[model samples]
Target: MSRLELSPNFSDPDAFYAALTEAHRERSEADSERINARLILLLANHIGEQQVLEEALSIAAADSEQPR
Candidate 1:
């Protein structure tokens, strides 16, 4: 089984967030969503593990219902 790494693994999380926000800045909602969808697909392809990706999808869906 693939190990799920639940950690702050980014070397520069703030920079990544800033870049992501900048990509969405001044964009229409639909365009922002397209960017998100494409990004997820690209990253999922990079991961290339169906089981791990499914686990991630489940975790994300569950987390979406929780209060931040």
Candidate 2:
């Protein structure tokens, strides 16, 4: 079974966030969407596990559909 690592895994989360924001800076809405798509695909590819990826998709979808 795939373990959903619900923990702080990044050594420099702040720096990673800064870089992510920087990547979106000066980009149009469509451009930002494209970047996000590419990032997701790359990360999913890195994971390379259908079960884990499917679990992630389900969790994300469920969470997003919930009332905040």
Candidate 3:
């Protein structure tokens, strides 16, 4: 078995955010939602706010586990 790893190259946060927003606007609704989600994760990672990201993930997980 083999594993693959992918990483983002974001030299400038502002530029990346602008590009991401533009791409999202050009995408279909579903694709835009997915891109938005990915952008959140990527931006969080780029900001080096691991604690905030972890807390957000935990909250999301907890919410998903609860009944509607």
Candidate 4:
């Protein structure tokens, strides 16, 4: 099982952020939420690794408890 790379893995993080944010442009809350859900599932499917996805889910759940 491969481990999650909790580091700077994106080649162009800024571009990705821009694209993601742009995708939400003029979108309603519900639409944006659906977009996010679809994106997550698509990425997870691409990864095709249960262990890594579980690790990511655990980290995300833990992070949600943190104060922003």
Which candidate comes out best when scored by lDDT? 4
Ranking by TM-score: 4, 2, 1, 3
Give the worst 10-residue stretch by lDDT in candidate 3.
1-10
What residue runs in model 4 are displaced by over 4 Å at the alpha carbon? none
Q: Which pairs clash in model 1?
A: none
Task: Please give, for residues 1-68, the per-residue lDDT of candidate 3 as tens digits.
Answer: 22211245457979877886789776799999888789777877775666666766787698899988
Candidate 4 residue lDDT tens string, 2-62 = 9999998999999999999999999999999999999999999999899999999999999
> Hey, what RMSD does candidate 3 come out at?
10.0
TM-score of every prediction relative to native:
0.90, 0.92, 0.43, 0.95
Model 2 residue 67 distance off true place after TM-score fit, in angstroms: 1.6
lDDT-superior candidate, 1 or 3 = 1
Q: What overall lDDT, based on C-alpha atoms, would model 1 receive against the true structure?
A: 0.93
lDDT of 4: 0.97
Off by over 4 Å in 2: none
Best by TM-score: 4
Count the clashes in each prediction. Answer: 0, 0, 0, 0
Candidates 1 and 4, the one with greater lDDT: 4
**How well is each residue in 1-68 modelled by candidate 2, as lDDT tens digits?**
77656688999999999999999999999999999999999999998889889888999999999987
